[model samples]
Target: MKELNSIPIENIYYMLCYSWDKLDYISRNKIGIEESMDIQNLLCRILVDEVDILIKKGIKKNYKELNESSSVVKGKINFKESIKYKSTKQCKVNHSYDELNENIIINIVIKTTLINLIKIEDLSISNRNKVKRLIKYFNFIDTILLNKKIFKNISFNKMNREYKFIINICELIFDNLLINKNDNSAEFYNFIEDERKMAYLFESFIRNFYKKELKGAKVYREDIYWELTGEFVEFLPKMQTDISLEYNDKKYLIDAKYYKKSLVENYGSKKLISGNLYQIFSYLKNNESKSKKDEFSTGILLYPRVDKTLDLEYSMDKHNINIYTVNLNSKWNEISKRLISLIK
Candidate 1:
């Protein structure tokens, strides 16, 4: 069997920032995510640190279901449900209590998942300190909901706004909690082998960066409508761009492509993928009518930097298109400069 590679934990942060639309999380708390650290340890550290801070300020409190005999009752008393069965027929009025909130439910779920991961031999092979600290954090949490059910469909609002990062992290953890039949070291590796997912992350990271950092240019994901009208148009698929930039009467449609091998062999010659070129061409053709200054409208097919440097540009009657690559492995300043320079 061949050894499989794991997705870096930093990439997961990038994924989270874009998927959750939490641009500030990565920018604010940039610590604890190092490329040298194992992903499992990184996740544990995130849980511990985020939860510890909340614990210091005190756990977020909300009104939860509580039914017991109290002198004063705040919420509506469930008399029928509470008095249905009593071991002793004692004169005790049951009142629905509104004690602490269910915000700790997030902590309970995270800690339980951490416990399960600790038992797995595949993921538990490294960073003993992380394991010990996870256990301590698990023990520190007082509310222990033994149910190992993952919250797949959670709705977020202002009440739980601060816990968004924690909730999203737990979502990623739950997706990775596949049942282990035997002690296979490759299980963790196999779980993260989806290149399509990585591609989407790479695309979204670029889009969000433009939306946040671009000063004068307006950046957004543009939806290109089909030129044809009739039943065929309704049946056709949606043409959605990864990112688009518009400024000073010029518009640039950018599509981000991700792959391990940047070059594709064509007719015994190395070149960019033909299908990508076709797709970008089609997008430009269908949307040319909407451009105010078609002469300045441009299209870009962007790819992550691989082994070779491939940059090409072409200009037609009213449209200019280019194929460019960005190196994500470079320093933050360099990456930012390269992307921001696109507008110029």
Candidate 2:
């Protein structure tokens, strides 16, 4: 329970000792400010995250054990056992972990904690494994799925592949921060937050994933054009607004949605999206006014691929105004090949 901010200024030497303690005394004092600062920051993050995982895990574990045994005896809280507050004079680390602890972890406290983790290598691995698994599982799910609920299933091979891109970066963190075979509930809870962050980061590449690979240079206004689906004024009265586009001579009105595949089945199959149909129906009604002598004026809803549908089409307006689904999941080559098959 010592205040991290008020650590003994004398303990600064302990930090310095631990830093170069890995190296000889000559190398210790010779460390650069930048390198030392880096080590110090890394140590701080590791320390802070540790205290967070440990305290939370220990409390919950004690409670579960108490209830299971049907004992009313109160468990002792060892404040001294908790080195949540510690300080350092030297350290180094790489990427920063966003502090997801319920409490705002003090910077100094975190540094102190990391120092102790190294000092007590003989300490129980139970807490260490908890911390490591929590970090790894979270970072993994967040990298690929990025959904808050994505942690419900981690055993799938598809989800596991996402770890390959991140392994090189996380190798050091896993080794230093985790006690791998330990059971820790606090670590599990923390995984949810970690998963959310990683998944968000992974999906940030949505635009990059579907980038266009033009065969020849695309003309500024030729390959794709925003040909008005209907006169802007007339398109407005059909329970909707127009502003529809004609991409590559396809007479259609398009709306963009970033729906994942899971939502597609739940919403589209259960008949929950009747209004969506009406909205698109309006687009067709308006755009139909602009149809050429041959082709139909269609309404298209563009979305990211989920179940890998091979251009599934649903009929409306007696099969005259067709609504088609497009895939956003495959590699550019596969997608382009599928697109050729779809357009015809």
Candidate 3:
């Protein structure tokens, strides 16, 4: 709701984060981003521009007493407001930063903003030539790029139709790369962008460690659909769908969560905001049914694997609802391998 020019960087972060949640799986997963790279960049740029533009308007103010700073930004930032974050560990790391916290709000806002601005064209064949490399692989790059490139590339748009093949190739590479999070730039943001990123990371774990030389059986990822019927009927409106591992016709759901290890054993009812186990129970009840017999659906409430050491299980009906605790303090890739072995 708050335009880039008229709001604080945090507001923009909130917007991008909220918008990132609404995106489809492909858009959310293709890029390893807190707000999914492109939105992160674009929103960052928009906010920065607003800050700059507002500066030109001769707006000047400081909220150091209240600890605010956007007013100090040339345009859209409140550098003073971010004073609270000055002592935060992040401020001490980047050399591009200062100890004074002059632009704590503006600088972080800029850094992350730039981090999100990777257009297909930017991530394309020209600047980095990643496009040419990507073309030799996946085919549906264009569609994925269309979702991230909220801007236009005059050169890409003007290219001869024949180059469409190369363009398509670039798109594919970008999408595939996004779906994979091995890039250094991806390390710029935290992994809490949205449920889909969490979901993508979960599947990536399966492919990276479980798939081995056999990586083509991920059809269940795409086969999952939002149906108004079946055991998942009541939640059809809100349960944000479920993750499935479909081999032939057998589909299993992998519902993920980003929970703190200290608080991982309680039901997600009002009493327990930190721990949420029944959330998976609800999904299991809604997603797994008898008729889906050939395809069994079990919900996995994947907490960001941590050393909290509290693993759990629920005896709901006859379903062996597994409430597994992943140790995020170390790594998250093992959840899949662990699940595969546990179920095997």
lDDT (10s digit) by residue, model 2, range 239-272: 4322233345544444434333213345346332
* Cα lDDT of model 3 by residue, 259-304, tens digit: 3332524455322232345555555565544356322455555544
Task: Give the TM-scores of the predictions, in the order they appear.
Answer: 0.78, 0.28, 0.36
Query: Which one wins by TM-score: 1 or 3?
Result: 1
Q: Which ten residues in a row are the worst by lDDT in model 3?
A: 92-101
The TM-score of predicted model 1 comes to 0.78
Which residue runs of candidate 2 sit more than 4 Å off their true CA positions?
Answer: 1-250, 261-269, 290-295, 308-310, 315-329
Worst 10-residue lDDT window, candidate 2: 59-68
Instruction: State how far residue 110 of model 2 sits from its true place (Å).
Output: 32
lDDT of 1 at 184: 22
> Which of the two candidates, 2 or 3, achieves a greater TM-score against the reference?
3
Compared to the true structure, candidate 3 yields what TM-score?
A: 0.36
